[model samples]
Target: MTTLAEGKAPVHLWVVGVLSLLWNGFGCYDYLMTELRNEAYMAQVPPQALAIFDAFPVWAIALWAIGVWLSMLGVILLLLRNRQATTAFLIAVVAVLASFFYQATTDLPQAMGGASYWIMPAVIIAVTIGQWMYANRMAAAGVLR
Candidate 1:
């Protein structure tokens, strides 16, 4: 049996924290690979997709960096039981929204404008929001301090 008063985190916290870490880890990896233009990694990416990424404005790229890096940091904070995880995740959410908004307003390549391209961003936005909400809930519950 466990209780909040005991100051021991519930199993669910660990579960969610680990899962969030892995998910965000991949985001970080993608960001690094794309920014670094790693040859082997870039090789597998479609040429149209690469061209679209190559055209991103500096501000959009900055937002993308913030979104990926901060989300990873937020997950780390969550696993550490820090209340600031909520704030980190909130900032990440805003950055992601801003980055996606820029993408939406731009004219992307026809091959890159398919449903397949949209699905990943949609999923990323949903998961980012979910992580923020979960962190907020955990903080409110005294599970994160």
Candidate 2:
């Protein structure tokens, strides 16, 4: 139970969102610079990490590049999610789960290269939880109705 003025979002949510913004920006840079697919640099990554993208062939790089843009779009959509919290929450939830998957598959193996991934997802999850809980509480109090 959070105090009204205390903010429904815990510190983790804001931290994650900030991380998401940064990582997405980095992804965008990697794509625009065409550096993500650089064979020489790619070779430096652990074989397992590189293989995940390799499995997708050309699609992987494109998707990698697109992730940042999609996240930004997600944020914009999330803002409007007040009228559509479910949809927003769903997207945020998927992202949170994906972050876990990514960490399990790629991030935690060595040095957790991407701080952006860690930060963004955490924030989204925290905020979403807070918002939903707050909304429910308000609704119960008849404020929403």
For each candidate in turn, give its C-alpha RMSD to the true structure in angstroms: 2.0, 8.5
**Top lDDT hit:** 1
Residue 122 error for model 1, in Å?
0.4
lDDT for each candidate structure? 0.93, 0.47
| TM-scores vs. true structure, each candidate | 0.95, 0.36
Per residue, candidate 2 scores C-alpha lDDT tens digits across 5-109 of 334544443554465556545655655544447766565666755555455434434444344455555444333323233344345445445544554464343
Mark the regions of model 2 whose C-alpha exceeds 4 Å error after superposition: 1-20, 27-36, 39-44, 56-69, 78-89, 95-145
Worst 10 residues of 2 by lDDT: 77-86
Quote the positional error of residue 22 for candidate 2 in Å.
3.6
Q: List candidate 1 segments past 4 Å from native.
A: 1-6
Cα distance off (Å), candidate 1, residue 143: 0.9
Q: With candidate 1 superimposed using the best TM-score fit, by how many Å does residue 81's alpha carbon deviate from the native?
A: 0.6
- Which 10 consecutive residues of model 1 have the lowest summed lDDT? 1-10
